[model samples]
Target: MSNNLKKNAISLPGAIAMSIAIMAPAAGMMFVPQVVAQYAGSSVPLVYFIALIGSLFVANTIVQFAKRITHAGSFFAYNSAGLGQTMGFLSGWLLMSGYFVFYPQNILVASFFSSQIITQHLGINIHWSLFSIFFIVIIWYLSTRGISSSMKADLYFVGAEMLIILIVVFAIVLQGGADGHTFEVMTAKGSPSGWSGIFFGMIFAMMTFMGFESAATVAEETSDPKKNIPRAIWGSVVGMGLFYIIVTYSMSIGFGSQNGDEFAKSILAMDYLASTYVGDWLRIAVAIAGIVSAFAISLALNNAAVRVIYTMGREKVFPSKLGITHKKYATPVHAINAVGILTTIIALLMGFIFGPYPVGYGMLGSFGTLPILLLYVLASISLIMFIRKNHRDEFSLWSHGIAPIIGALVMLLPIYGSIFPFPSWPYNLVLTLVLVYILVGFILGLVLKRKTQNLVQDVNKIISSDGSEKL
Candidate 1:
């Protein structure tokens, strides 16, 4: 196993594109609006606003870490540097697990949209599993081609996704909304559950912005990582933050603020908005955008996930095969292939058992969100601890201390909401599954610590070394 990766393979724009593509604003708008509307009503934008601020705090913590350490492991490296080897190993496990769960979710989304678009426009009804399988192949190939290829593909997908969203937004603005533009949505007046509803909606709203920090995952591959990684992190956070706010507002007004109930009930809110504000042609375009968004996020997740596996493998925390990169491409070929195969299998099994929609919108979607949120909370806490112990002289009250604390606290609200008023069946069980996964990782970490003897020291050495050196 080797720690070497293709150096300076990603430029600043590429890094930013990877982060934004992972967020998949098109997919977020397509799926999130109706759910958010159900809870926050016309205040959907407000929920996004709160989510944006919270995500910024998380992004800030990540950027601070990025400035110091450049590694393929990203959050895993940050955790190792800030906490210890055990915690860092667990962080890698948790993140990898989250992506494993999310891969099926992405597949389901792309499949669903692809099927929907074909059935609606072409009058052809293809099963979603076919689309899922098709996308799996595409993602696998792109991810294995290396960071530069994946980032380039992401750039095109993100551009198209953004253009479609902007078109819809501008159309809504020009024509005016159902009840016209108003500030009432920003308040609790439009929500059925009032402030509680707003808080509840924020849980889902925050999920829409998940993966913006993934820019840090490519630190080893990015040019001038110390400068570009932070820019990418902030760029993705602020860029998507504004995108979510404007798009949500447009959807709110497009659906008519007074028609909150109808909007909440809409399963295809984005398509509905397109039809109402633009035309049927635009509705088809939104569906295409959904497919592109899903693909982009899948690629981004693969890129981030494989790197974590590569780092763990290099450290002998997981299988060493994952640590080895493609000699030609310098990509984590084994890890990428493993993830692609596993994801395809999971997507098929879930689709066969629960049906595509349930696997897509219900189980896989709900399962993926909590684990990632848990990672955010852990990462934020790690940032605070890392700064206090190691970088006290360089730390600021806000950037190092107060910000991460706020970020962790803000992140906790959603984790609590996901569990506590827990819904029925599968969702209530997701937390238990996540706990079991973490426990397994903990035990493995303990075993590795005993076997490796100097695991923590090795991790510290890796973090402390110059970026150009191979571990």
Candidate 2:
């Protein structure tokens, strides 16, 4: 087995597929709009629009590092390259921990939807664990086959789900929705608490775009890491941002913004909107799209998470056993297996422990979000210091200095919202858990520093390209 992933195995569309799939546009649209609408009132579109702009700012910071560093560790490598190897290892540890935590959210979603479809349509009350086990088996198998194969699957799954979702969105536009096409939903005035509501809702809006950076995680496998990676990152963020806004806008109008109280509570918002605006057939189509979206996201996470582990292992920052790749498939087999086992363990444990829907998904999802959100905040700071030290001559105030500072600051809004005012019960426990995890990472960093002659070298030994190409 080789330590290197299959280089140039993924093209631009394949890379873009990884980002879009993790987002699970259809599933995100079905679930997130309602969650945001609770905070935004009827101004869900406005919140998403705000999140889009914010994401772009942060995306710029990520693009800065990605253009110069291509590695499977993604956030870890970028932070290390720009901030120093210590911060880099911590970033990798935190990001991988986040990925490991978030992996089960996808499985929970897939199982929840699968169980719902089976129960509602077939009247077969099967256990949710059965569906979860089935999907994990499939997800693990696909991931071990190699990224090119998994990404091709991602491309297909993303296309199908988006098509069904877009059809309903278009229908809503053409028919002027339930209350006629209106711009109120795009205005802060429609919010329950005006700009405050809309801005707060932007926190949830940002989560829908959570995995857009997964593209960078597969940089080693992607074609033209320096050029195509930037394109894929920007393309997925902007493209998905627009996609989210349109869907939220359509749903807002379709349900009538005045009816937001009801819209904000619908678990299957897409099914209701499709049925009322289009027909029952489309409602079923949207539901199917949600299921496929869940599956696609699970696969995307499986691919991205394993690669992060594989790179860390190859770098010797983690157990080297995780770095081993299938000689024939050129895939990270051991890391793939690790993610599969962990996700199933976490999903099954949490699902049974807290009930999969409200408590399990909601609390764990929010917790999983913190580390990655912190990655963005940390990466933004790293961008400034990295460019200043590494490419002093090329650094631009707008591009490298002010932009990242703004990006890092804006990225903190969600972090603030996540804890401030203090969340209830188990959610509050996330704070303590996050602190403990970071402390553990810090202690691990100290031990590694003592063992390795040069911690930086060991932390960044894994490489893709020399990263000298002008982008």
Candidate 3:
């Protein structure tokens, strides 16, 4: 590696902002609540509750590694430290795939919301592809600037999104809800589809927690990384968890139990709720929040994907040029550009081949979910192994062992649900495609291990570095 990222460029709040942005609480409320309600019925809150618990366990497992091994590679470095170099590379590749897949989905979301807002308010009809390309270009520019700049933008966008959500949530509560709040929504008896539907709903429920671990990816850029990164990871889960539960509950009550079918059928449930409880103006605000949330996540995920590639490149697992940072900005310019261009190409291709809505919003969204859950399982396993073998003196049975095991097991539920039910054409195909991608990565890892002498040592040296070296 010949270039270094700026050290101490991000603070605790900045890191936390990025993590929350990546989670995209506003977007989750919009996209996930209706679908979850369709399956889990009034038990939507409970589904989010279960997902929150799983996210906490996974966050704790990640904290275990973040506090010990501070690296920009995040899951890549953590798995390498806990497992071996090969597994680490595989984890990185899988994690990268997750981000790559999600990038287009975010673009699609931005395009969709932007189109909706313009067509509804401005009375102008524009194709979503134009807005998608515009947003993608904006994301590319922001991400390539530097970590500090990108995260600062994240703070603004995420703060606005959260503010809108909170406004609508409080409005629902103060209005006493359409049917009044009750604990019945938390029980399986309230579910229209019963327990089976609740289990199926868990798959999407867990997906809302997808980017909570994102702070760890910026460990190298954060101030006091060993301390801040762990806090950001755990704080993200707690913050977003509370946000999801409250919004979901308010939505459940606001829409009223009698209107379950209406809530399920509505394309933008939260926006409809906002229009009913607050005002039609709040619908526009929610739409704006959706657009901002999508843009913020795209920026955050791009930042994360590039760092993983930069780390791998540094270790010679990828092209060495990808390891180079911008001389002035100290950002991973090469890797960022590569990811941006590739993401744009994929987004355009998918839009052309399958249309923006189906491919961008549907297929790409499903493509990322399974790999992320798998990565969570692998990271948890790596934590368990690392603690047992290396950090036995400091390890606690709960945080180091039991928590990760529970995390791995809880994550499996979603993975199983995603596959066993065998979703319709495109979604079912995503599972097979993700497996094929990982298989290819595993083969590549094996080849790299055989060809690159001292590959493990290089990875170790890079992860263990103190930010003074190029790494």
Candidate 4:
């Protein structure tokens, strides 16, 4: 590792900003509003609220973990410190699995936008899978250069995306007032299914909010880790949550359940919402912004995944070659390449199986959510255990103890809904991916454990022979 490169690379604000932007894409109006509305009906905003509260609890646990022990591996290291080596390895593997699967998932979103925009405007039909592969390759190359550059690009993309979403929200609210509605589909009283539906709907809402805890993965390179990690976690929680509620509220009014036929036209929901309330030009702009958000997310995921691999390699859990830092680029070249190649292959395979464009994307997005949730469950448990054992002074019984236990149960509700019964096609696909990841991770962790054990034994022998051991 180049000490100078690491020192010069990241700042507290920059890291926080990067995390916010990366997370911001998941809360895009076009993304969250429709999904929430699908399950919760007029009560979509409540789902966002429920998920936000769950996220805040999870965020607190993560923040406490980050404050004490800063590492690039993030939740993996936290669980390891709190639980033990085997659980830590499992956490790291789960995180790695999510990061790897999620890269292709985001690219699928970008490709959907790319294909939709082109076919709609130019009336051109292109090979979406091939085009998506090309798009992923370009991002992989750019990411191999440096995370700083990737984040710099994200600054622009995230900004444009947020601006467009804000405009759409404003237009929707204005139209709602004109149509004589208060835009408070948020009323808990009217919802027939009530909080039951809201909680159920929140499973998907929480899926969209997966990347916030990811900020901790950058701690090794982030300046002022203590302040920035906490700020990034809380700031993202509030910012993304507010955005989700506002956008969903606007969409509910725009949807206007008054006319059954018109309201059911939620398939082209964003297009209809924008054209009806905003304008055709504004709709075009929002579509463009959605595309940019997808690209920025893809770049950010690539940056995070490569760093996780590098961290694991340095600890001798993964191959050491991935730990090599490039002298010129100050990036993890091998790790970056590994992510790129794997994602490209997965994208190709998925494209073949699912057909092209939007369908493939829906599958990837759904499949990717399961493993990410599993990782969160592990992290939440690790926080409770770690605080109870290591930092008993900093945390009390409720914050570290009861909160995490409840948090874990809450997190699992979504995972259980996803796997055993399989709610939807996307849910089923995601469950399969999660199972595959666990099976592979179990085998790999065993091999790594043996290798690590040998290294520990050698070190112990050296210390004992040198008479440097207290025992």
Residues 229-251, candidate 1, lDDT per residue (tens digit)?
Answer: 99998999998899889998888
Least lDDT summed over 10 consecutive residues: which range in candidate 1?
A: 450-459
Backbone clashes (count) for model 3: 0
Per-model TM-score versus the true fold = 0.95, 0.95, 0.95, 0.89
**C-alpha RMSD for every candidate:** 1.9, 2.4, 2.1, 4.6
lDDT of 3 by residue, 1-471 (tens): 246888999999999987888888888888887888788877788899999999899999998888777778788777876788778878888889988888888888788778877998999999888988898788778877778888999899888898998899999999878888788778786678788778788888877899989898888889888899988998899988998999988888887766666777888888888898889988888889988998888888888889988888866789989989988788888998899889888888887778776355878878788888999999999988877776578779899888899999989987887777677877777778888988998888778764333545554564456644422
- Candidate with maximal lDDT: 3
Q: Model 3: runs farther than 4 Å from truth?
A: 450-455, 458-471
Residues 1-471, candidate 2: write the lDDT tens digits. Answer: 887777789999999999999888988898789988887877899888878887898899888878777767788777876777677778888888777877788788778878988899999998889999999998888777777888999899999999999988998899987789888898886787777677668667877888888999988888788788888989999999999999999999888878787778887788887888788988778878887888898899888889888887776777889988999998989988888998999999999999887678776777777787788889999888878876788899999999888888877887787777777788778777887888888778666753322434533443223544321
Error of 4 at 22 (Å): 3.1
lDDT score at residue 113, model 3, on the 0-100 scale: 73
Q: What range of 10 consecutive residues in model 4 has the weakest lDDT sum? A: 462-471
lDDT, candidate 2, at 142: 77
The list of candidate 1 runs beyond 4 A from truth reads 1-3, 451-455, 462-471
